[model samples]
Target: MSLCEIVRLEGYIQSSYLAVYPDKIMLLDGCCRADVPMVLDYIKTTLKRPVTDLKVVVVTHMHPDHAGGAHKFREETGCLIVSADKKKQWYSGIGGRTMHFVDIHLGYYVARRQGRPLKNLYYSASL
Candidate 1:
């Protein structure tokens, strides 16, 4: 068993990563969706799982925050990227990633006060 951690991205976007093995990495939010730039990967690597050794990438939603980099990860890690909604998983590569649309409601919301796409914009450097 390896270590697991919930990496907070730009905003509400959170990605979880786990190192089931020293050389095996499980990216809960593999899409670079949050655009944390190695935050999650760092955590995973800190647990002895380097990106090169990674073999599993998991995407939570179709939103950019969770599916933006789905294609990149698959190319780099050569790992099986898992996600939901076949249409949502867009990647120009073979065995890019796995998209499995689960039958569950994940509460999504937009901040009425901020009037921004808070629902998916986590790493918003816009001020």
Candidate 2:
């Protein structure tokens, strides 16, 4: 069996894992929206692979630190998004939208605490 290399990428507010195989790549956790460029750069420049090689992105949860970059990745690379099958989005309705906003701010707070510059972490609540 072939082995895959797992690389940990430091995100804006958290870390994400990238599973690299010869033909494809999978990202564990979407990471913050601000981290999209960094992740893509790593795949293209560091890994020396085409961005389209990113085949899957698993969003473990609907938080800014976990699912923020999912849609952007899909849009940029045409990658598939994998997540829990749920009837409704985790962030739904007025209250859920409020919480989504709060969560993004919370991510910013964490970045500030880590001495990182604030970045745009806003993502659509529904995904």
In terms of lDDT, which candidate is strongest?
A: 2
* Per-residue accuracy of model 2 over 11-112 as CA lDDT, tens digit each: 888889999988999999888899999999999999999999999999989999899999999999999999999999998899998999899888888989
Where in model 1 is the C-alpha error above 4 Å?
A: 1-12, 31-36, 39-45, 85-127
Candidate 2 has an lDDT of 0.92
**Best candidate according to TM-score:** 2
Task: Identify the runs in model 2 with alpha carbons over 4 angstroms from their true place.
Answer: none
Instruction: State the weakest 10-residue window (summed lDDT) of model 2.
Output: 1-10
Once model 2 is optimally superposed onto the true structure by TM-score, how far is the C-alpha of residue 84 displaced, in angstroms? 0.3
Compared with the true structure, what per-residue lDDT tens digits does model 1 show for residues 1-127?
A: 5554444344333444444554465666644333444544564555545566567777675544465555666666677867665643243234322221120012133233434343333221110
Residue 71 Cα positional deviation in candidate 1, in Å, after optimal superposition = 1.1
Give the alpha-carbon lDDT of every model. 0.47, 0.92
